[model samples]
Target: MKKLKIGIIGCGSIAKHRHMPEYHASSGAVIAAVCDINEERANVFAGLYGAEVYTDYRELLANKDIDAVSVCTPNYLHAPISAAALNAGKHVLCEKPMATSMEEAKDMIEAASKNGKKLMIAHNQRFVPSHKKAKELIAEGEAGKIYSFRTVFGHGGPEGWSADGKESWFFKKNQAFIGAMGDLGVHKTDLLRYLLGEEFTEVGAFVETSAKIDADVDDTAVCVLKTESGVIGTLAASWSYVSKEDNSTIIYGEKAILRLEDDPVHSLIVQYANDDTVKYELGGIQTNEEGGQKNSGVIDHFLESILNEQEPAIPGSEGMKSLQVILAALEASETKQIVRIN
Candidate 1:
């Protein structure tokens, strides 16, 4: 079996815990090389994955053997790195919040088009079996006409999840450009959009830096979205949850109400219009820092898109759509008004 020659652009926890392990576990890929600005860390990751290492991503892209790369860097670098790789003739798997701006996101899509290579975002929630089930039920009309939803992804903050803790690049506006909205909020943004198969048409948001004492970025974000189908919902993404919850989503419709979460048991539940309740205490598709689950199932599906020439479950355009929703929410939060998504 031929394996895709893959490189990873960042050696951070997402790489160490998600991408590298998934690539190693997949029969479709091989870790051909890894690049990080920190050479020591890059080399360490490369050694563990049996790949070469480079400090400069430019040098890594120069490799002829590498056919694809996962852009696991900070938000600002997503476009440049992914574009460079695509132009250099490699498929790209970018992490979420596609870019800081829609322009950047379009550039990624265009580059992939210009090169005829695939570009996908790692919105792993799509692969969670519970999520998949929810999508199925919603699509099948078992949930009836969806009316509303509330989704949240919160944790104690970047101090625990990032490479530099509170000092992590996530809080810096230049590197991350936004705070909880970008880091934590964007995932649910993508999930809600995907599960419903609808675009968020308007947004109203409130964002705060209520915790993380000295951080310049927001530690919590709450946004309300109006979907094209007349669905109204709230999405909250935060880093100040006091470890109170993992990521979860609830949807209410004419026929039933649905809930899904990442937990040891009771990962998903539903109560029908007739008050028939069912619970699915299931496992996640992939593992996280807490060893809960992974987004790698999302990663593997993207790899199949590459290897088989099928469409990515979540492509660059879909990622851009998700980002646009979040960006509008950010703007709404700043202005204290509803912002239209055009």
Candidate 2:
């Protein structure tokens, strides 16, 4: 099969650390072009990868040789760039918090459907080894029927991950839409939904801009979420975890409690009501602080989906569903009431 030529838009930290490197390392794909508003950053990645560079993403999208594009830009640009790429006869791998609004997300899904192009959201948490294992265990009834869960994704701040530090688009309300809620919360939303095999039906949240100075968006958010099957849980996303990060989840079940990424030594642990404990050292969960030692399976899956003409695991519709949870949480925070997911 011919290698899928990939164009990377927005040469920021995620592009540099995750998308570009992973695509370059994948034998099924090739780095065909890179684009960023910062011409120097684009040139640097292009030089390292030996690909063409562009300051404007539209120009990169116009390149007919590029079979796919990674939309690694700010949250606000995700929908527009991904829709444009799909319409331009290119498959899209868009970064998460799919879009700022449901309207935009719907438009992206519509564009991908109309263009008959695969649109995969880069919710890399689903590709984590420990997460995959947990999902399997749950499916196998290792934890019995899940009753509740508390999942959190928190870190010092996007300052550590963004190329521009504190002044990155992450802190700007217009660019980021919602700070940690969109940045970290949506990841957990996707993961929890994947693990439980259910969709969120309602949300109640307290979103605040308490930590980062002068930030217009919320830096901390605690949401109460209810799944379609009546499972209740808390989802917390924050940039205020200064000393250390907590990317962990504890799922309560009828037979056992499954702990994921809660221990330094064990990536997953199961404690049963019979006083038995089983620990599994699958692999460390990827984090903004420690990153990942290996390339995330996202690029490989995306390439395989395109090459085989199959729907991606986290397609545009799946992304939209996850985005709705966060959007409902945001609305709940603003309205001071539980918001129903539609």
Q: Tell me, what's the RMSD of every candidate?
A: 1.6, 1.0
Per-residue error for 172 in candidate 2, Å, reads 0.4
The 0-to-1 C-alpha lDDT of every candidate, in the order given, reads: 0.86, 0.92
Task: For residues 320-339, write the lDDT of model 2, one tens digit per residue.
Answer: 89999999998899899999
Residue by residue across 126-225, what tens digits does model 1's lDDT show? 8878998999889999889999999888878877767677678988888888888988788888889889998889999998889877778888888889
Highest lDDT scorer: 2
Name the candidate that leads on TM-score. 2
Question: What is the lDDT for 157 in model 1?
Answer: 81
- Model 2, global lDDT: 0.92
